[model samples]
Target: MAHNQLDLLRQRRFLPYFFVQALGAFNDNVFRQAIIGLLGYLAVSPQDKTLYTNLAPAIFILPYFLFSATAGQIAEKLEKSKLIRITTAMEIAIMSMAAVGFVTQNMVVLLIALFATGLQSTLFGPVKYSILPSVLKPEELTGGNGLVEMGTSISILIGMIFGGLIFAVAGAQGPWVAGVAVILLAITGNLVSRAIPRVEAGAPDLRINWNPIPESLAIIRLARKQPAVRNSILGVSWFWFVGTVLTSNLPTYAEVNLGGTPTLYVFALALFSIGTGAGSMLCEKLSARTVEIGLVPLGAFGMSAFMIDLYFARSGAATAAGLTVAGFMQQPGSWRIVMDLVGIGLFAGFFVVPLFALIQSRTPRSELSRVIAGMNIQNSGFIVLAAVLGIALQRYLHWSIPQVFLALAIANVIVAIYIFTIVPEFLMRFLSWVLVRGLYRLKLHGIEKNVPDEGAALIVCNHVSYMDALILAASIPRPVRFVMYYKIFNIPVMSWIFRTAKAIPIAGAKEDPELMRRAFEEIDAALAEGEIVGIFPEGALTKDGEIAPFKSGVERILERRPVPVVPMALRNMWTSMWSRRDGRLRRMRVPRRFRAHVDVAAAEPLDGASVDAQTLEAKVRELRGDAA
Candidate 1:
């Protein structure tokens, strides 16, 4: 539907939903920050302030652990747009109670309302992520999720700034200002939610389990059912952990390390938030509008790089005390610190956005809501653990903020390695992503439109070079089990990547009949499972940059399984380094077409039942045109 990520902002389907979610996040932060402001206004004892501040997060997060399972079922059973409206409507009631607490200066009432706010958020959680897949096409998931994350990041930051300043500017009128502001924001969210177009329930006829404990376990099991999805959920929780640790330390870090006033703490947070927002928005462009999980590894390493630098940038106390934001910026190594914070946030965005998109795209639609619910439960645990561990490391172990950061950076690398090791797809994708992007400036034509988004399909493409499979895989949004030549599949370093990608290795029938039969069996199994299978119907790389006669293997495979066949072409790859144009020894020579412009085009799918190998080859030839 939407060609660009920004274009979605102009459409009613996404725009209204985006604003509603952003408004809800804005109001949530405003309410919480206003409570802090209220405490300051009353000039409560530091002990009391510490008590409330510490207690608030636990209370807010508890509802996620308690009610998220039920919420997930409800989300699956109701129309998505209706569920959103109901959540926004609930927000109005919850924020109204918060308003009363603000005006009455009742801490008990405020805390009760805070719990209610968390309950509302818990209920909204599943539908928040689940609705995107319903409204957006597969190709739009990354961009759409990017916008949502960006909006949330910016909204929370701005809401904190606005809510925190209400007390400073309004002083005696602070309570009234906060009360009115929260209620108005809630109402606005509700009003905007009305414009979100109706989307059908993910599992309308499904029965709900009212029990939280068992349902929570069941949903978590469901989330972990797929290895990629499971690892992705873990990655998302890790992001939250890193975020909590990094953000929670900023106040102390600003004061102790930078020798800056309280205002500098906010300034530091603003930089991280802005960088995160920028990174979130950039996911679409970086991913080429696909659900590119390859960015996850890049993001993780980038985050670690910045965080480690932050420790070395200034590992000790400030040279001066009580400097303002401007004065801190004027100090030596200050710009490096600023760059580190922004870089950390920026990479954090790159890390999380693709994982969300992957979860949505890969999970079955009927179970997506509950899966998201399960992820929320795990995320809550991670946030709590990060908070506790951060405090313990600093308070009990006597680790400085910089030391904690350094530890976190190291821990991040460990976690990343563990996840990648368990599910090498993330790492495989990353490697292929780098190989393709580094070698060529690739462009796609009719891929999103012509390739099947779901269901088993056969893709027949002319084999131009050894890198064709990776290039095609990178260009296409969905995973394709390429039927690569067995030798290429067994190549020294590339073998591991191919095996990890689950590429089917085939031998020529004359060369090895048994292996060829086994390859066909695997191909059939993959197609039957509703997975895409790709074949170089030409059977080998073109020797003279011309299409070889299509082999009968495609027809034989199609006869056994009549799935749709998509004709695809890789252009300008024949002259690439891996192509047969250069002899073996000459292949080692320096590449001349580095970062060459390459095109991958897909024609509309042809019915496998009727199309023979020759017709498919003609179609691919047409798609390839004169590019080779």
Candidate 2:
């Protein structure tokens, strides 16, 4: 039975870590919001309040610039479970100091405490993300990230509400309550951290570098060495940039453009956060539990579309007094504005979850923590850049917050185009995802366990239709190099996709001997490089919806390279649009089937030398059963 993502919360391996991270996030928000609330309602002068409020976010973010590199090294060098416990212990101490600051009502002490908390968060960032891959299965990466993001979003919202409500109702006693709450939360986080199963240090012998500047540069350079990882980091950072701009501008946007009160502002925040939480959960269902970057582009598109809609939804007239949340919702065109905010948040979830999973899945395990630290450094830079740009456009250029949003939407389009063009894999995956998901209902059996996660393996499947390679490619999680007949490989639209996927094209020896020789050479080199090379051993599509005679090519390939061969069978595709059931012309004339049920089954791998083409064909036939 397949367990839902929420079921992970009950398991010991994941639950403890989840609680620790969630409590930490909750504490951070509670303390930060309490401080902001204090400045807003209790400060002596408007000037003083403005100064502190302006400086607060900067103080918290500064540590990322100073300590992220060192933090990354520490996470890589130490066992994650021990490091988390230590970090949580430090959090308890920091919250104790914050409690003192709250009781004393000293701005200096409180600011210092806030800075200390930021440092604690900076140290925890790398471990929080890097440990997921270590603790969860590869198939669970997307679901796990969704759960984490949802938890964080909900924590932030709850903390914000608690901080504001406690301060409002308690008066002078508010800070005391706030202080005690955070302290208790911290202690609880530490207690939970103790239960986390110990994860082995990824790079125990790695030397620590105390110098932040040079080490930061080196870590980024290391991340950039892998193109996909580098692009994913950029995508993740860009999300932060856009998100910061939207969030930081919300209070003023609500006040000036929407004519909304504090309650309305909170309502707007809730919409965005809830939308993000919903979208994060939706990722597992949309991507079919795989880490699909195709959704990233889809997310980017929705983000820009709704952001533009939000810009247009802005009312030009300003009000001296803001409307209450209830009053604002009742106004004409207000629901559209709210929906736009929700849409942006929803798509933001789709954009970020997959990118994070991609980074975790692609980076070398030993360096994953450091790479995440590098990403944090870049994220901080982008956030700072966002603040600067937002200020310049609104203050210096005399642009309204709505105009800034418009500019941001445009910026998202440019960034998406640039990244997709540079890394065509993202676009290729999007096309493949659309083809498989839109056209067919796919079912898989034993593909995840039977196909080796790492090392060279030749995948041999019985071909039933022209879309066979695509169906197989989309069904399996890993990238595959398909060796298909040259005619089908060069099909007008799909040829580009095959080329982008780096599929190997070949012809029969009688037709093109050179191509056949080159194909064998390419297969040998691909297998040597520990890649998954897929081939249809029957050599061509079945004309009468039946398996063809096995060919000697499989035996020849095995003679050169003795690797495990995974046998896969595709069923229910023989009657599909791409199949040559009636004739090529007639099949093309027939309307394509939508959501046709297709089953793909893979038997356990067999040793290359022991399994002949005939035996492998029989196994595939058995897996297919009576299905044509």
Candidate 3:
């Protein structure tokens, strides 16, 4: 299995998916920009103009509310690669209609085409997510998703600028050109889909639900059946709600409050999308190929903080005159505005990627498409709500654009407060932050850079010391759930840390057969669903500082649910007091000038057919070079 995600993207399967999705994204923004630009230039009144632009998204997303459930069912029932082809074919038809609407200058036809395009996307949703698990190794999901996200956002920015500029340059012919481009893109996307290796139907007998309202509700109930799946979906939905509200209102704030032309509004959009792109890439780079939910809160915190600063930083309106994007950057106070937008976008990526990966990682493969359908349902609903709320703030409450920004920032606090109360794990992660703040943190090289940003992973390490768990836990940027020997689980004080980290304890055959059974079961369940499960293949901490003989437990776990096993080596860890043969074990009183210097060297995940304890141990030894 691939370690670095950048390497993964170079492959045919992933790149096609990436570009196809990006093309769809560009199509989305290009058409929307065309409509918004035309409305800006032709709408009779300013009031009607913003209403028309904001309202466009609601109408288009209406299909998500209408078809996500049915689409999800379709995805689960049919072959996904074929489903992608069908969706691309549908895009071609939709773009053709859009071209006619644009050429005839028919607003009603345009709206219909926009909604039609949304319908095509809604059908594509389930297959889009389901294909990741089907095509890429479990470890490749996070970074794969991250790259897709970055490319999509950049595509949006490029499309928007392209649409606006092209309309300026071509006027009446703009939409015709955009339509032909979209059709060509769709055809290319379909060809790419045809190249994807076959992924059979996940649930061939899955039933379809045609009605939107009840079907949408049922999808949520389906997700609710699994705790991790539900949390992941809820987290995913929350990100969308926050994102929709911010993105919907950004253009208005940029024009009215930031005191700039439409070009500046475009700049704000670009900056925010760019920031989100950075955050998405960061998730992969920081987590070392694991889906780390800890960063979710970190991202949320930055999002809220930056949003708040943005509102407060606004000097009400531009003092002297309007400024372009370049001029705005040069303005003394405007830099803060730009930075806040960038940070909010960046944090949004952090907030979004893991949540998505979490859903993929935690949800059962059988029902993954349905759960994704539920997530899309929530997203579409929330986007509608966000648009309504933003418009209502302006039209009903008579709030200025900046006032809406301030209110949304304040609302972030309330929303976070509610979600944390519901999910205490987010709050629990904060405790680690507090503890680490009082301690020194050791940095590892290419450790986070080497791992996939999403999906399920089984990490195997050589057992040497009791502190191995903590060393591995702290070293990986992601939240790792270690499967430790039962004896250590009951240790005083440390038990709480294990509980907080959600570590699972296991026992040997003679120690407790029943407990060992349960431990294996948990490991299987976690890996089968896509969560990370770390293990020490040596069975127990060595009596000597050297690596011990490999055991069969990890092999047993792999037998239950086959996945990639990434080997990691903790160098110099044996020299620490936690080493099995180091002078003292479990003695916290050892002298400490500073924390030990340990290097986490990662090896490519073992292929399932070739993976065994002996092979894995040898790889670990090679990674370490000399004995620790």
Score every model by TM-score.
0.99, 0.96, 0.82
Clashing residue pairs in candidate 3 (N, C-alpha, C atoms within 3 angstroms): 142-453, 142-454, 143-453, 288-448, 288-451, 289-451, 289-452
lDDT of 1 by residue, 392-480 (tens): 99899999999999999999999999999999999988998888888889888999999988999999999988899998888788889
Clashing pairs in 2: none
By lDDT, the better pick of 1 and 3 is 1
| Tens-digit lDDT track of model 3 for 112-193 | 9899988998998888887787776545667888887899889989988987776687766676776676567667777776
Stretches of candidate 2 off by over 4 Å are 318-321, 584-586, 589-593
| Sequence-dependent TM-score of model 3 | 0.82
How do all the candidates rank in terms of lDDT, highest first?
1, 2, 3
**Residue range 137-191, candidate 2, lDDT tens digits:** 7667888999899889888888887777778888888888988998999999999
Off by over 4 Å in 1: 584-589
Give the best candidate by lDDT.
1
Task: Report RMSD for candidate 1.
Answer: 1.1
